[model samples]
Target: MPLNPEIEACFEEMRDIRRHLHTCPEIGLETAGTAAFVKEQLDGFGIDHQDIGANSVLAIVEGRGPGKTIAFRADMDGLEITEETGLPYQSRTEGRMHACGHDGHTATMLTFARYLADHRDFDGTALLLFQSGEEGFGGAVKIIEDGLFEKYKIDLMFGLHNWPGHAENHIIVHPGAAMASEDRFDVTIRGKSGHASSPHLCVEPFAAVADFIGGAQSIITRMVSAHDKAVISITQVHGGSAYNIIPDEVVIRGNVRTTDSGVQDLIEESLGRLADGLASIYGVQTSFAYHRKHPVLTNSTPEPAMKAAARVVGEENVRTKELPAMGSEDFAFYMQHTKGCFVWVGNGMDSPVLHNSKFDFNDHGILVGASYFAELLKEVTRQP
Candidate 1:
């Protein structure tokens, strides 16, 4: 691999960008300040591009030789977690933090942007997508709807997530789903409310709610095929207002995830039936409401293209952890339009899990990720 010395020097500058953005975290697509920061860097490189749907920054570097247009993606949104890293440049905006490492993702891509602007190695084009609202609100989908392909005409896309714990310089890839589809539901069980002394005369929604939670847990364990994976968790359950009085209603909120749309549909069906069954058994009224979040994030593996890209980084750095993650990513929206793989680079086992109140993006993974993006660009351009 031909690593540019100037590109290597930009790592420190990339680190500076990461820390600056980390101090002032933004929430969603309305990242005016963050967008401006990225725009300034793109301007410095003299690379021309357009902003789609508010905060997503797209820059194109036309390669020197010959090839097709391939795009590189990075997320820029932060989470609603308070900072605890205690770094001198800790989050200035209290209760908002770069918990998902988008700070690093954004800066790393900026590093690659620097690399490409300096080297300009191949032909065709390189698209640097700095996306926002990826933590929620389907940012990738919003960009596509806003005419990403119509404007740039991307052929193959590549994205990497700063993963937690494996090793530095480690890269991963494969085929099929790399991440699961996430859906959420809320239920309200209703029953007649009466005095504690009149137990026989009144129906309790709490009883039905408890029965439903228990019954819902069984749906994944019993109704779902043992081989087929699924997750059903009741995150919240609230009912009685007093120890003795039977509450009029109980509310339960939960989330479900699966590797395919079929499994997600099954989860919805089973929950509805289970709610009906609980209502029937308890002689109470029950209601279920569901919201589908995002679809499966898959990659084309065997994937000589992606694997060759990984090899450019190094064989040891290439990982085989192709198992689907229950956590959902909006990048799934991008994969729907182009054949690509979303790989996770280790974030560190010791690091706080994403979205945690104390979580902060680790700075050490900067070059590891920048190098991966730079290498992937070179590899993809080399192929048809």
Candidate 2:
């Protein structure tokens, strides 16, 4: 599909910006350099912007008349993985890389910012949010705490990511849940320590640990409904200090993902109950802590996204029935307070999966994503 000619014209500059960001990848909430670069670009475009949240940049583009306020967010953090893509623009920062395509997302948002600056023909305000710490750093929450919703009466918001394993021109929109919620848990089982040979004399905590791991799976199979989707992964177990010594306490850590809020609630409650049950049955002291890292990303207002995507790619290329990804995104937190949707623009059918050392954001996504946001601006601005 041919992109908007105006947006297509910005491809070279966009690619340059994306490559520049790829070289100096920043991680977590420490995105000062990246935010400075974004602010510079906004200034060059004659757009008004300010610092918000932890090192986040928010730019404003006013329209011709009064209408609803819309927002576009792009994450600006990289991962701890080293870049192995071998591109000339590969990361210069060791032990950090834009493996998740946040660099590209930032570039796309910048492209749209430039376009909106020259042509603010819509009827509402456009907020260009360059967010930081999206890679599990609580950047979005920090921004909310910093008064994102309290300051602006935003009517709708939107965010997009480049998705690999699909055609480059494809645009995927989920009408309901787009990404799963992330919950982390730690289970500590305490018991008596003794010699390894004294199996009967010592209250080994591994028995309770083993039972908790097995019982955690039952929560999904037996407790959760068959129609609901959920996963409980036991990622870590730390216990023994020596080869033969029975440790006094065993710590178990795991992750949970679900598309439904009720299922999230169910799994958390069930895991706590199972931990208590294991303690009572094995005569061990158990403590469980569950932390909700990110909420489930639901498309509260998907029609505007669908229409905007149809305008960018062809109607046939806009997919609305894709299953929710098990992966989580901090953008989900914004959905809880506003009306909007998160979308996926295809990176490429043969591209490497996200967060892999070999992964790189497909540069063509810059035009595709920018065009979609431009169209979405028009869609929301016309709303009552």
Candidate 3:
């Protein structure tokens, strides 16, 4: 219950900003409007900022003297989900909404930036990244390509997401992997099409598709070790249009998630092998393609985050025992270059899960998140 008084005082303004951003939801890297709004807020607070990546806004705050430069990121893009929550500040966009709570994240960062404006006596610099295109968009990659890593000498980085199914006052930090890596695969099975009545005449592709689907699950259970975690989900399957006619080709698409890179490589290799096996066994031509989207988000330094969380929310509320999420985050890309950790602040126990149509970012979370970030700034930038 002990939150930063300055951040607590800005709750109403932070709520207003969150609600305003919620009303006009932007998607992917096309967050020109959202980035503009964030820049406007930074201007009001007299913080120096500039455009980076596609439309990501990066704000710089210089401290008392030179030390470890810490960076904090907040994703600003919304999902392509229609708002079903009957809140008055519901999304005005027809097919887009802030279902993932990025609005709240941006608002919380802005509130913390406001606090930073008044208090900058600490050591080192603070980089506040109001990034766009976190929803499967290469926003983080775009920023890096645009010279984020080259221009700035960042010593440490940090980020947070509002997670459902936990208390609002609770803070969760992972000891190692915080989120999974995302890989997508597609298998195309090609065969001759012929009359359904004459089964022997046509080389059916459904048989190969079935075997591939079943074999995918085996890759997780049989190939992957029991201790290591991985998931392969067959999300899409497309085949013949007519029931009577055997299709010439059947396409199967699936998603892969894993916490370890070695496991990721194993699953991708096993899936390709399974597809090749189908070609030999079913006498059909098979093509397999795999794409690695995001890498596993491993927390290199957990002690600083854990200490900061315990400082804001009591030690009992700062959780470290929970399992790492299977969900993937683009922030993992940032961690690949620098040392940092991503923590999850509870939205609320009753809050709707992320990406749900009815999901909304809990307002109370903004206060706790900003306060935690304020404390984290102190924790990481301490004179060592």
Candidate 4:
């Protein structure tokens, strides 16, 4: 399917919005400016919006008759890095940038807002979710807590991400387990601080932490199935200030990612056991803290509504999953509550990777994503 004139024009509008957002990058949950921009766009199309979760904008596009209420969400947050792309529309705010291409995501949703509002001769409601704090702090969960479902009464939800690595427009999707669960860990070991010159005088926590970090790796390799993939990365370790003396306590922190929930359970259970045995052997005290967040995103099937829309965009542009990435996304939170699959829109091969200072969202994908959103509405909200 070739691009329609309406879709082509949407890309240009997206460029205008993207450049404005790129110049002013804001961070964290307080995206007042960003949310305001989205609200303004919806208003321009004569659509109504409701504010929820501090900075989140939720709008429902009510169509002609009754049908399944589908939702489309886009995050509105930026990273802490400064822009280095040196583009004419580069970020003006120092030490702040839309390095993750959220500006692009927001722009695409706005374009959809315009197109859908203009073509509202359909059935059912289309909910627009311009959410806050996707980078962290559990934004989606908060939106749900703020009565997202109760208000919109969404039957299905959909999300899209701009992927850098795959062939520019490959729309990957997995029926189940598209992303993993994220778990963070903090481990501390306490020992007797003593002079390094005196051998065996101090129960060395530094040595004990080192042993535990290494053992943490083995837990995945030895305990989990060989076919399964799980990672335990001890990213931070702080122990001693002086080489001459052993520190009384050593702190180690890391994160865990796994596709399998059973593996995550084993990780926590095994870590508890390992801590007990290590403390007894080294004659030191051990403490552990772990947080499990963002359950896996499992799509029951290729969202028939989204897939039909993908077909309208041509086979070459739409891609099904061969394999999925390990990186987690908060969109998973919405998918868990509704029966919809998150799709990946291409930002071209040469575009900067997400979160990189040089990264910028490819404007080429703007119309493609918007068209998908529009086409999805036509399919899902059609005459009976």
Q: List lDDT for all candidates, in order.
A: 0.80, 0.94, 0.94, 0.81
**Of models 1 and 4, which has the larger lDDT?**
4
Cα RMSD (angstroms) for every candidate in the order listed: 2.2, 1.0, 1.0, 1.6
Runs off by more than 4 Å, candidate 1: 2-6, 64-67, 301-309
What TM-score, to 2 decimals, does candidate 1 have?
0.92
Give lDDT tens digits, candidate 3, residues 1-384. Answer: 379998998899899999999999999999999999999999999999988999999999999998888999999999999999999999998789999999999999999999999999889999999999999999999999999889998999999999999999999999999899999999999999998998789888998999999999988888899999999999999989897999899999999999999999999999999999999999999999999999999999989999888988989999999999999999999998999999999999999999999999999888988999999999888866
Each candidate structure's count of clashing pairs: 7, 0, 0, 0
Predicted candidate 4 versus true structure: per-residue lDDT over 1-384, tens digit per residue: 555468686676679888899888888798999998888888888999999886999887888778879899988899899788999999988899999888888888888888878787877888888988988768788899898878766777887888887555556666777777788888889999989987488888876887898899999889999988688888999888887988899989988888777888999888878877889999999999888877766666466644654665676556664565677888878876778877777777777788999998887667777777777777666666
lDDT of 2 by residue, 171-246 (tens): 9999998999999999999999999999679988998988899999999999999999999999999989898999
Candidate order by lDDT, decreasing, is: 2, 3, 4, 1
**Model 4: runs farther than 4 Å from truth?**
382-384
- Consecutive 10-residue window with the lowest summed lDDT within model 3: 1-10
